[model samples]
Target: MSKVGIIGAGLSGLTLALALHQQSIPSIIYESRPDAPLNIGGAVMLSPNALRVLDRLGVYERIRTRGYTFTKVDYRNAVTDTVTEMQEFGGKDKYGYDALRIYRSELIDVLLEMLEAAGVSIKYGRKFAKVLEETERQVTWEFTDGSRETAQLLVGADGIHSTVRKYLYPDLVPKFTGLAGITAAVPTAQLQAPVDLHLPLTYVLPGKGGFVIAPQQVDGSEQLIGKQRRVEKDLTREEWAAFMADKESQVKFLQDIDPAFPEVVHRAVSNIPHDKINVWPFYVVPRLNAWSSEDQHRRVVILGDAAHAIPPSAGQGINQAFEDVYMLSLLLSDTAKENNKDYLAASLKWWQESRQARVDQVLELNKQIDLRRLPQSQDSDGLEKLNFEVGWLYDIDLDQVVGNWLKEFQ
Candidate 1:
């Protein structure tokens, strides 16, 4: 049997494990966090591209049962309260999936449950501290506890501050955007009074770095939405709490942006303490010339945040990782059949070539989103073009991207 090892039990890591399992390929996952569910105070959108991958893993029905499918995407000017662009999501029944909005924890639970059913073992508290690749046949991992394990292939699905990334791209660091996201969920009743706009999975309010508000449905549970301010990353925890402490102040600030803003911001305030709100300093590893070695055949490779960490502005971070898994899984399957063997080296090479470009394109789009949030004076005609051209993002096709991999593999 070919042993595949995955580090990190996050969305990306778990998704990769599930994909491999569907292929009847066995793998093990090592998680640094204690064995417990993480409840981050935010929601995420799973585009049709991502939904297809989940469905193939047999988790889509479970996810849809838990989340709300959203068809329309609307963007508005935060200052003028004018709708800038609205578009219908393009990819659906073609692959039998649609965009969805769900809570972070709910998504985690669904993936974890599927992984468990696959008989994939996730060793929690076993942090990946170091790794060394000797040859195509052998790769070793050193955990924080001084324990070690060897595998035929090692994957670094660990998130942003990935120990694997550091080992590979030792000189590079994810650049901070200077923008911070303060996210929290609020009750629907609290929002209905001040703002009359029917919400979608996503809404953008234009301003200095602006705001985004969207609904998130927990797995088979209740629905909730989040409102967040895009601000500078320099604020301390104390500053963030103090700023949100006064509901009147938050309301007044929203009023300046748009009369309807208060309806959204106030709801966010009521759900969690001004203090419990999470302040995320967005960062990304910009266009990397490449993610593969000189020969393009190595026992190690990165997936998810470790490979292409990007800001959430476009909501592609998680979706992109799912795309990676779908594409790479197909490639590996093809390589196995062609060689009539494991063919780990050829699989890694083909996977890298197939995935790197798509990942780069998504990273660039995230940059465009960041540019759109810059001060009005900094905006240009190009930025205006981007606001109108984001339709592709909402309409990506994962199966198409996977292309030949499906034929050669499946």
Candidate 2:
């Protein structure tokens, strides 16, 4: 059997590698980074839809113990300092799995451990350059290191700025969402707020900016993850530097919103070292006519952010990536009998068709959530509708969805 070549060691690529290993498919991952453990991202929320897939991969138990779990979210008005709404966000009873909050590094560590145990090879510092050639039998990838590798299939799980996506569809590009996300994590004990610390997650929406505060466990330490989103785009290096350097002004902005708001969020923001604060501009991938090469025989596919990147408002970015890996792995497993180019091509087409619609829905849902959280929208009904849509998203069962897709193939 020809080994699968995976690009990027991100959550999607690593999960796909593990899922394929479960089905006895041999594969290797080529990461552009130069090291095994890369700690470059902030906290992430894993909803039940994603947890269910991780559970199937046999790693959720380990992950569950390393993260904080929450079941409700408090939506408050930053200007009035009043709780507008409280919703049951996620729980096993509601969605058959718990919603977890953990640093992105911890999750990556768990994934790397699983891959190592499975004997999956990951070559670091192997930046993907472009497709060198594609034949009926195999597709070859050239890397920046002036090396090349050939495999039966190439899966691009890089990210929003994916070289693989550019190789497959050079014209498709990610569009800026006109929003920026600033995040930081601090010891929960540092917060001097009088509000109940044990309460559910909280979101304070004021003007055109929104703040999300949730408790998280990083390296066994209790920390609170504070995320702020505002309508800002294409910030230059100097502008970003200036923004980070003025911590006092940022704190004042929070304090001015609501006297109580700063107590809960300001401490976390101000206490974290300036270098530790993360500011990322949000971008979304335009809906593609197809997520894979038009010629099925080409055997090149894209998943996760490469396929469809969405805003973080819905917290479905990582969840949708897990779903992509699960579905693609299942379809590839079904092709094990034939184990040829034809079967591989057919499986890739099925995987793309099976996932594209759901991806479209999730992207649109994230957009709607962003709109409701905008400064102009203060209606409780909009918040309620956003909550309902989120619940609907987390309730989807990828296993059942794949089972139905298999029935059609049968």
Candidate 3:
């Protein structure tokens, strides 16, 4: 029997299966989508911390040639075209792996392949309905089809709107941050960019928000041009679908270029691929009282966006999720030994607290980056120029963490 039953076959769940398999722990994944794993939002960015986890799981080498790698993002003055600041997202020499931007489907396909090689099973078309029962030793849940399954532990990695989370907080809903990011893909040749312009940049339009141009694809032929704006009201699903379906409106929304930015900005918005348009409404799950059940069972667990849909400023959304599953898998192995039943609750508590601490750090990093984006003011907020450093974020050693924590109990 599968020791761990994972709900959702996205990055977190698939990666969790691999991590568990490495520790000789068996796991099964349940995905609602009948045909494929949950692969949306186009391409995703990965920093060093996540790269380390993927490398350890033997996923990085296979995907290395399928993505564009970079180390820094230049935040430039839109008018003068002068780089105002630089943020290092990754560095092989410093953090041991460069940042990667790859298509969501490509990564998911590779993960699925790896899971197959590892003999991990994934059940498609299985939607998690709700928790049927939970005890100190195991968990059982039902699907929307009325079928039931049980496992030694249940993990909810079901993105932002998670059904398993309902078992913990019945009324909880993801809080929209009142901002929506609209973007589209365009050929790099369309921009006709200057030779020295660095890629993956945030061109700060004078008073308006930043306009982003990030390169993607194996050859960097395509770039994602994006901008965000305040959204006062949250649209319904049908409304969102209609809004996105109108290609004319999406073009107009992205083409609202400011006069302060370079002519390249106007050129980048000249022709956006209709099929490549994407809109991401920012939503965050509030800091929860518990990521796991508070009772003695602690059988139902939630990670990734299910627990915290962190702000995207730091690009740690999926990266941090990788951290969660990997660390949890390692800890789960420790508890698998005989006579460790007494420490089950304590182990989970420590895991949640430890993961929460890193997530809190990432949030703080987001605030710092946002503050840095403000217009240079000699007076307001009294904010001094701060250099971006990510050693603490990327240089983490999860094995050391597991070992150190076990020592406390040993």
Candidate 4:
């Protein structure tokens, strides 16, 4: 069997490596960052679908013990200071798993631990420079350090600014969504809001701005993951500095939305160190014509944000990445089992055919959710629409899909 070269040891890359390992496939991961276990960004919501994949990878139990699980989502009107809608999170009953909120760093740590236990090789600081060459059977990747590695197949999970994606399709680029977000995590007890701290809440001021507060546990400390988004786009460094420096203005902005909103904002801004607060613009990869190279050998394929980057507003970015990992790993496993000359190409074709439509649907659904969440929308139909979409997303069983695909090959 040929060794697989995976770029970027992110959620998708690590998951793919683990999935391949389950089938006894050998693979190596190349991470650009120098840190062995990189810790960046805020919390991520793992829907039942994501949790199911994690469970299969044998790490869900560990994550669940470290993360926060919630069964309800409260949608509150930031202007009116009232709960506009409430929905029950359908986890075990609907999808046979629980929804979880875990910090991005915590999730990375868990994945790293599992990878180490499995004896997977991950070379850090190996920044991928470009593809040096590709033959009929293998592709060679060059690193910024002038080092090079060759593999039968290359998978790019390098994220939005993926160098592999650029190497394959030079014309494609991620587009900014004309929105800016500020995210921080603070102790839940520090929040002065009068809402149930146990449940997740989304406060919408409509068009002006909005935020979400979800309970999470990071490094054994009970914390509240807070995220605020507004229509500001292409924010400069000085603008971000000004925004962060004016803490009172931020509190007042939230206070004007609703009295309770200020409390959450205050807790996030005051309690969290200034450097920990992240303020940046959001970008999404435009729908791509192809997610894999045109090489007849199928030498290169991109997954996760490298293939389909979506805005964070939908909360489906990481979830969809997990889906990508599950499907690709299964397809690759099937290819390895068959040992057919064209199996790799056939498997890559099947993987894309199975995943592209689903990715398109999620992308459109995310856009709709973003619009519905805005304050200016007069329609109250977002709740029903969101519930339907959530069910559709979280209820999928990738194991069954993979089984059906295998039966076709058999």
What is the clash tally of candidate 1?
2
Off by over 4 Å in 4: 87-90, 193-198, 218-272, 335-338, 377-389
lDDT comparison, 1 vs 4, better candidate: 4
lDDT (Cα atoms) of all candidates against the true structure: 0.64, 0.73, 0.87, 0.73
**Would you give me the overall lDDT of model 1?**
0.64
Name model 3 segments beyond 4 Å from true: 335-338, 373-385
Work out the TM-score per prediction: 0.81, 0.87, 0.96, 0.86
Q: Which candidate tops lDDT?
A: 3
Instruction: Kindly give the stretch of ten consecutive residues in candidate 4 with the minimal lDDT sum.
Output: 377-386
lDDT of 3 by residue, 1-410 (tens): 24989999999999999999998989899999996887678999999889988999999998988999999999998889899889999999999999999999999999989999999999999999999889877898999999999998899999899999999999998988777778899999999999888998999866566889999999999999998756788888898788778888878988998888899899999998899999888899999879888764888999999999987888899999999998998888874453566566778889899999999999878776666553432222555556788899999988888889888877
What candidate 1 gets wrong by more than 4 Å, as runs, is 37-41, 78-80, 87-96, 193-196, 201-209, 218-276, 290-297, 335-347, 367-410
- For 1-410, candidate 1 gives per-residue lDDT tens digits of 26788888888888888888876778999888898644554667787767767777787888786766766556666545566666444236543466788767888898888888889999989888887554645578799899999986778888877887666777887777665555545555555533446455334544444455555554313334333454655455587566656545444343344444534544544444343345556677766544433243366778887888876756778888888877666655544354444455555556666567666676666556556544342423355445435445545555565565445644
Candidate 4 per-residue lDDT, tens place, 79-176, comes to 67678776445467766876788878888888888888999999998999898888778899899999999998899999887999987788876777
Off by over 4 Å in 2: 195-200, 205-208, 218-270, 296-298, 336-346, 377-391
Q: For model 1, what is the alpha-carbon lDDT of residue 7?
A: 89
Clashing residue pairs found in predicted model 4: 206-375, 207-375
The window of 10 residues in a row where model 1 has the poorest summed lDDT is 219-228
Q: Candidate 4: RMSD over Cα atoms?
A: 3.7
